[model samples]
Target: MKKGRNELLAEEEKILAPYAVSSRNSGSRAYEEPEHPYRLPFQRDKDRIIHSHAFKRLEYKTQVFVYSEGDHFRNRLTHTLEVAGISKTISKVLGLNEDLSETIALAHDLGHSPFGHAGQEALAELMKDKGGFEHNKQSLRVVQKLERRYPDFPGLNLCEETLLGIMKHGGGYETTQLLEVRRTLGPSLEALVVDVSDEITYSAHDTEDGLESGLLKLEDVKQLSIWKRIESSLPNSEKKSDLHSHSISRSIGRVLLNLMVSDLVDTTHQTLSKHKIESRESIAKAYQNKIKLVHFSEEFQKEFTELKQYLFQNLYRHPEVSRMSERGKETIYLLFKHFETHPESIPESYRKREGEDGRMRIICDYIAGMTDRYAIEKLKREGILWFPY
Candidate 1:
């Protein structure tokens, strides 16, 4: 049986590029690891994402609340897991690479800061002269340069396809500062599914999380005509204030899943019938529109703008989170300053692996990836990293 068609499968000549992160996949795939017992190529990618310190810090990073008063709120880690799960489920149903899908989903949020975007925004503002920072770019930082367990490498050394998916997030053929999803990757087959899955997962989940966190209400959705149109286009569901977010998420998930399944299946069937192959072009056309409609809806833009403002004004810019943000920026900047001043203090392993360029970027990458709580802990234990001589 054939592994389902994707961008990689569409190439006329099967010229496999050398991927730093090898495939950790299972039975029936021709492109899986060759007799490597410790892991499959995809498994390695998934494991790298799971074991990284960035993944652990996600527990404290924001999904909605900056530093929500509750334990059950969906932190960045849980959110990533949810997105990964959704992406994996869809990828599997569509016969795409589940590990790669999960890899992209899990690592997507690694670059986000302690207070989520608020902390991220503050940091970006502080460092505006230094090329600025974006969370998606930071996720790339995590994979390529942050995790230090392997004695040398900075990142998890992920595969090219996974990297492209991480970069593109299913938007356009060009890279932009606005959304990590807009970056251009050469092929559509592999990139489309992973990127769309991220949108399908996060849009539904964030809306649910926002409502659950008391930041949004059904009334908010009900207030807008266009949103109402989109909502009416989706399935119906009962609303509970406390459970509104998850319920909306569930309702929306069903709609999204049905859309993806129907589109992929219809496209695949049509491709098989017409061209005697699973049609990447057909599925690409069908799924590409989803990026514009479901992911980039004006209704979503208005709500997210509101939410971003609310979080900054209330939750993130709130006194508590503000204190944490100050300390976070201090920790990041000071840590970088420390490395800048005393390059000798840098870990010998990291130093040996990377020269000056590696030394400089690695510190920023590591500190920027930390959550508010984790950064505070590091600060407390290590004290201010910078030493002015």
Candidate 2:
């Protein structure tokens, strides 16, 4: 027999923790529609996110490396998938809503600019006075206004809980356009799981990419506390001295992921118990009282922070990475300048909204939606960037 939506909701009630946001309690969508006969609300949201045009563009958007850098490096799409995977694992083990966690993870980076943080910084500087550019806010805007999939709504019209999870992932909820999302309460446990999963995925995967690209030396990486701990844990037979770089990088990535996830799950369980967060209402109450119930322990946190700092110094700031970052920023700046002076060059869809949203914002929206290759190709095609003979 096929399990209907009611059956799934029942199963969630039985299986998920009391604090987990079940489909039955999911907040209403901005625009109400009949529920699916077989799919849960969060499951539907995950599907909607996967099908969105902006989600597809993530494939060419940067994570730590540009699309042209290489095929093997992690791009925004791969990074999002990894976050979703990790979030689901953490949420399931903790008896939280895995579907909601995965949905939030999938949508977290939808607003990221084409060239990763470099592109975001460029856009931020360009629009500093024009309300500024933050990827999290932009991501909310993308789901709430920019996407035009439905005839009746401007955006995806995602469930209110899903939207809240997205808005609260990176911490600030005061600026959210959703009136129903309470700023007093912190994000749900599912959302918190997604947030931590994002950190874990990036810190580990970026290191792997850096090592694989030879931007980070094995010797330098081995000096980090987290790496040292991981190395010491490995048996002598598995720790071959002359393993290939790719093999070594993969091994390090797998171990790092396991360490972070295991620590987070165990510590979070202890946190939930300490705070007495037995019900959804108590979760909100705990947040109102400023209790953080989802995080790594103090000891593991210091080690993880050290790993991030090392990556920031050695991998993210490497000369080659910086050169590409600068080039990407320059591309965005030049394109924005050209479009500002010549609004006619922008697409008709964006141009049509100039009166209501203003010209600068419209321009930002258009550029923010572009893929790295699209932006670069457009620049070359316009003769803004000349090719040497």
Per-model TM-score on C-alpha atoms: 0.62, 0.96
Taking the tens digit of each residue's C-alpha lDDT, what string does model 1 give over 81-179? Answer: 777776666555545556666877888788887766556766566556655667777777567666766654446666555665566442222343323
lDDT of each: 0.55, 0.88
RMSD of 2: 1.9
Give Cα distance to truth, residue 225, candidate 1, Å: 4.3
At residue 22, give the lDDT of candidate 1: 20
Per residue, candidate 2 scores C-alpha lDDT tens digits across 1-389 of 89988788888889899889989888898898999999999999999999999999999998988888899999999999999999999999999999999999999999999889999999999998987888988888899999988899889989988988888544333454563455655678998888899999999999889988989888888777787778976656548855445877877888899999999999999999988888877888987888888899899999999999999999889998998898889889999999999888899999999999999999999999999999998898777873321
TM-score of 1: 0.62
TM-score of 2: 0.96
Where is the poorest 10-residue window by lDDT in model 2? 168-177
**Would you give me the overall lDDT of model 2?**
0.88
